[model samples]
Target: MTEPTFFETPQPVDLATIAEWAGAELVRGDGAAEITGVAPVEAARPGMLVFFDNMIYADRLAATEAAACLVTKKHQAKVPDHVAVLVCKDAYKSWAQVLSKLYPAAVVPADPGPNTISERALVDPAARLERDVRVEAGAVIGAGVEIGSGTVVRANAVIGPGCRIGRHCVVGPNVTVQHALIGDRVYLHPGVCIGQDGFGYAMGPQGHLKVPQIGRVVIQDDVEIGANTTVDRGANRDTVIGEGTKIDNQVQIGHNVEIGRHCVIVSQVGLSGSCKLEDFVAIGGQSGVRGHVTIGMGAQIAAVSVVNDDVPVGGRYGGTPAKPVKQWFREVTALRKLAERTPST
Candidate 1:
């Protein structure tokens, strides 16, 4: 199968325009030069923009054929005379801005065609869609669903009955959303399963009794969930994902897990039932938090850790049962030294 261009073709932009977009000073290059694309320093060609932020890539920077390079004040002199140097406080941050300006249509699940709504989509007569909403082919909008203006329901996505999707949101292909209220500018990537039944069961000697789950999933504004992540609905309350929180792919969030605003949950992390993560708390990849535990504001849990207790505010924890990061490292070091000193058994 041939590859598809999901983003629109970027137009050629001048050096002056790129400098303004990146908020960088055109310290040593012709402002009139035109750039057509962006590339890494190692493979940059003429009319392409590149970034040089680290000294480790000095060799690559010296040999780069890019028309212009986004660099820091410290690396300005290292850039070749033939290349235009745009100095900034943070080269990487400025590069990000430039990329966004150059590729404005690079959102997940490419925009549906010129027409607002596709004729092939199955939208219920009772569903209320605001103006300019785009429903792509094979998408199913169930009864009583209210979709805000400027939202795009990508191909094959299903929005179940009574669900409310806010404006400017992107419901990616194959996404399944039910019993949820999604906020504005939220992005649900492909294969994401939202508002599913939580794992709630009562133990018994003969058999396990299933508990009834009746709560919804509340995803706040500006939040982006990665592909294939599964968020379970609450048993008796809403499973809340707060504003601006970003969740990575394949993460499993159990029933009643409350993630606070701006928290970052990395890939493969698991939060058990009723656990709470305060604002700005960050959990590293593959970490597991126990049920009913609370992680205080600004706390960080290191990668591959198993958190079994409440973590204090602004603390940094790691390891199984997750103690303070510093103590955990010291114990690991001591154990390594002791093993080195011991003779063979």
Candidate 2:
């Protein structure tokens, strides 16, 4: 049996070319030194490039067997003489640039079939699709839907009535979109359910009266939503996902949520209705923001946190009913010390 290779192998590139692409200085290497692949310092081979940014991995750098490595000036001295060194201000960002040059096609979603629409797909006569739009098998596009050029609607995906998707988008397999307007270069991964009814109801002793959700979802450009994530429609206002925001899998976004540009929401995060996240906010995995709360710009919420109130700008918060990071750490340390000092019964 043979192992599977999903991407094509790249040709060998010399150290000088890699330095040029990464905007790095080849401080301790021959210009002719070449590598065919990239790997971690711990797992590097003779023809692989590795990156080191911290002194904590000094042992790995000291024993690296790779052809070359990318490092900062402060840590370059620890690298083994057998391995060549390329110096850069930001090692991780440089590595990303080098990878982009090596694997150009790896950044985008995979196309399942040709650029033309498959015969097994169903499209209403009122729906308009621009040139180079590909619709795969078992997909259904409803009336008055407009899809732009260079977009691919993959297998079994359904676009409900009056939905508009912009150019260069990829709607993945088994996705459902209703009452939504998606901007250019948006990627909705498999099983993403958009614009569903919100959990709004009038509670009573005998029965619960359901409130009608009458709003839509507006997703801006360069947004990538992961698999099985659900974005519920608002009751009277729109739920907006801002441009360049990246959301991980299994996230639950409640109605009327407003996420600002370039925010990152990790997996299993639950956002209650009307929560607002300002620009550049980062919410870690398994975090929850209470309804009507606002996370200020550039704030960071640590993993498994519960945010119940508004956070000030640039604050880093953690713990349940999340507080400032320094205070949280102090409280945690105090509890641990108290536990250690108390006599056991």
Candidate 3:
């Protein structure tokens, strides 16, 4: 099978033009140099634009073969003389601007195309598909499913019975959504599994007894779930993902988890059952939150942190059994000092 391509063909843009678009100043090299693509410093070839932000990548920046690079004033001198430098306040932000201009999001066609429902798709007669709804080849729409207008259910995807997906949502290829009430403009990437049974079982003499997950998954508006993420259904109460939340790949959200508005959950993060994340909570990659914990609004959990208790509002936490950032840092420093003081045999 042919892999789906989303990016458009590269368009050549001059150094000066890119600088103007990125709100950067052309500090060095030829302004007329044409850049055809964007790449990292290590892999940057001629006619490609790269960004240099960290000093740790100074060697890569110095060896880059790109036509131009985005850099801050402090790092401008580190750039090779042969490459044009686009100096900006924030090199990463400028690079992002350049990338956005070079590669804008593809517009989903309203008219039927490869993304549209194929003749091979199986849609139950009882299902209600709104106007312009696209179901790709091999997709299965179960009985009583209601899909809103402009929603695209991709190839090999499955929407189980009674699921209600709102308008302009993209249910990517191989995704399986059951017992879910999804709101508008949500994007579920490929391999997403929503509304599956939660990890709930009773330990008894006759082994574990499976507890029935009877609740639904409520996904609010503008939420985007990354590829291969799994959201389990609740035991009795609904599992809710609040509006505008962005969840990264491979995340696992347990039963009855309540994620508040605009929360950002990075890749490999796991939220145990019954946890409540208030508005604007940010969980970094590989973080795990224990069950029944309440993370207050605007709190940030550092990567690899183990959160086993409640987090106060606007706090920054890190380390195992997560605590305030400052306290964690002090503990780390003390441990390091103690280690250094110990003599080897």
Candidate 4:
């Protein structure tokens, strides 16, 4: 299979030209140098542009093979004499801006490679099933289930009556989806059970009764769910995942969980029911949160952290009972200091 040739435009741009195009403040070294590629400082070759966003990597930038580099205004003087530097107010932001322009995202079509669809299955008239969308012998789909250009629906991957799967999305083997609106460039790995019953129970004097989950799952664009990651159906409202959210394998999302855009949820992270994680929040591996908690925007919960209450925005937290990142660092530092001062036998 031939991969789509992006970045194949042979327009070799110069350092000064790229800096000007990206609205960066240019510091000249060799304006005539032709830049053929963009890479990291450590891996950049001759004729490529590298970027130094953090101070920790300043020394590495001096030894880089890149003909030019992007740097922050504060760090411009630190660059070596041989390399041309493009100064920007924000190095990371500028780097992202430049790289995005150089290499854009792609959506590839899925070919249903030799799968047979049974006559009993109902494929939507308006849907475009790519190469391998196999309607299992007994599976059914509602109207307007537009499978993307390259999406494959394996045997028994029962898509709900009215769902929209974007391009290159794999309705993973045996996965069941219902009453959901999925976005483009989405990937659903095998055994991913979406729109399932929520774990809601009411305990009374007589017995415990289960609360009916009447909500659905709304997975947005550029989302990739790991294998077997089960997103429970909402109790009353939809469980929403913002665009570009990547969920790792074996993660369990409870009912009514609202995960904001671009969040990275690592493996085995269990979000309790009704937890709202705002934009750019990162949940480390094996992290678990209590129900009804709100993790504010840009907050990071370290691996294995147990969040029991609401977290503030931009806070970094760690430990079993999660605390502020600064506090966690201080506790570790104090412990180390105490050990150093202790009298040994």
| Best-fitting candidate, scored by lDDT | 2
CA RMSD of all predictions: 2.3, 1.5, 3.4, 5.7
Better structure of 2 and 4 per TM-score: 2
* lDDT (tens digit, per residue) of candidate 2 on 151-215: 99999999999999999999999999999999999999999999999999999998999999999
Give the C-alpha miss distance for residue 218 in model 1, angstroms: 0.8
Which lDDT tens digits does candidate 1 get at residues 1-345?
999975666889999999999999999888988999999999988999999888999999999998899999988998999999999889999999998888867744555666477899999999999998999999999999999998999999999999999999999999999999999999998999999899999989999999999999999999999899999998999999999999999999998999999999999999999999999999999999999999999999999999999999999999987999999999999999999999988
**Residue-wise C-alpha lDDT for candidate 4, range 1-345, written one tens digit per residue:** 998964444368877778876678777676667889888888988888887878788778878888888888778887778788888887777877776666643232234455666786767676556654556555666676666655666666788766777765667677888767788768787788888899999999999999889888999998989888999989999999999999999999999999999999999999999999999999999999999999999999999999998999998999868999788889989999999999988
Between candidates 3 and 4, the one scoring higher on lDDT is 3
Candidate 1 residues lying further than 4 Å off, grouped into runs, are 1-9, 54-58, 74-78
Best by TM-score: 2
In every candidate, how many clashes are there? 0, 0, 1, 7
lDDT of 3: 0.93
Off-target runs (Cα >4 Å) in candidate 4 are: 1-11, 30-32, 105-158, 165-176, 183-193, 199-212, 220-229, 243-251, 261-268, 279-282, 313-315, 338-345
User: What C-alpha root-mean-square deviation, in Å, does candidate 4 show against the real structure?
Assistant: 5.7
Per-prediction TM-score to the true structure, in the order listed: 0.91, 0.96, 0.86, 0.71
